[model samples]
Target: MTKVLLAGESWMTHSIHVKGFDSFTTSAYHEGGTEMIAAMRAAGLDVTYQPAHIAADHFPLSAEALAAYDVVILSDIGANTLLMPDRTFARSEPTPNRLRLIADFVKGGGGLLMVGGYLTFQGIEGKAAYAGTPVDDVLPVALMTRDDRSERPEGVVPAIVNGAHPVMAGLTEWPTFLGYNRSMLREDATLLAEVDGDPFIAVRTVGSGRSAIFASDCGPHWGPPAFLAWPGYGPLWANLCNWLAG
Candidate 1:
């Protein structure tokens, strides 16, 4: 069975609330990959999840380590997390560049996919900072330099560019997505889907491997309940994995 590694989509958040001279602060841990994992599992694939916190310490440090999985997905996690691992940042010890390992993994025929979020692509305030990274070079599209987010609380529907594509085989017209990162497709990549002229779903063949990009969240907020509930959601991701893993 094809195995997949999913990283990110889990976070610890701290918030402050103040009203009429009353102030309070609280912290919470949240995960958004439940639906994505479910969708992949439903698609008949084996998945291993690495939350943001764990990814910092456990994300593969070398291509050989990454070889444990057939497909790797990066979602809602910043480059810094992988670049500055605990061993490197906290221990002040030199470490292998995970970003380079990921690049080599894909180039050596392993599957890769990048899902968008505030900490993905050229994220909020450009803090995600993947623009010039090795991973970015292997992506099917080019990320923007500044913040690439497109906020559409009103929802923007995706247009299927090639329903004949394997990933779009069972998918018809897709439901609306709240928002997504605006990315430009590479000349060699195939545009599978789009939203308001921005690249929403794209794919490409990199070296002996395959890669794709879903410039939108797979869960809440951008995905919302309605989008996740869409009948095509599960199959959409399943096919993506199947194709990449091939």
Candidate 2:
């Protein structure tokens, strides 16, 4: 079985309410990858999740620590989480750059994937900030330095650029997405799919491993309810992970 690590896709929301003379604020936590993880497990793969809040404390800090899994996925999490851990910041203690660990892991024959979201790729306000980082050295596509999200209020559909590829096999049709991160194509990478004529999926072989970029979310607000319920959803994710593992 291929073991996988998924970091991100979890967030906290704060809400405030005021009426008459009383005021109250509330905070809630949410996770977006329920279907994604279910799909992977349905395909018989062992998977683990490290939500955004605890990523810095729980994410593997070295290539050896990361070696426990065959694939590492970064979705909707900023690079700073792994770059500047609590100890490194609050205590001024020297710490390793987990992003660099991921880069090295891929080069050493480990698979890696980066899914898109508000805090992924260049992300909202470009604060996700993976563009010039060590992780960029291993991604199959190039990230924009500025904000990269392309919000499609009306929704857009994805087109298969390489239907015969295993990643696209069993994917007869794709669901419409509400948004995605725009990425530049790499000359050495194989483009698998596109959305609104932008690179949607790209794959490449690293030193002794494989790497992939999926420029859209596996769940909402980019992936609407219909998309999450689409018949091809689970199979598509399973195939992507399996192919990378192989």
Best by lDDT: 1
Give Cα-based local distance difference scores for all models. 0.91, 0.90
lDDT of 2 by residue, 139-187 (tens): 8998999999999989899888998898888887688899999988888
Q: What TM-score does prediction 1 earn?
A: 0.97
Q: Which ten residues in a row have the lowest lDDT in candidate 2?
A: 56-65
lDDT, candidate 1, at 96: 91
Q: How far out, in Å, is residue 81 in model 2?
A: 0.9
**lDDT, residue 8, candidate 1:** 95
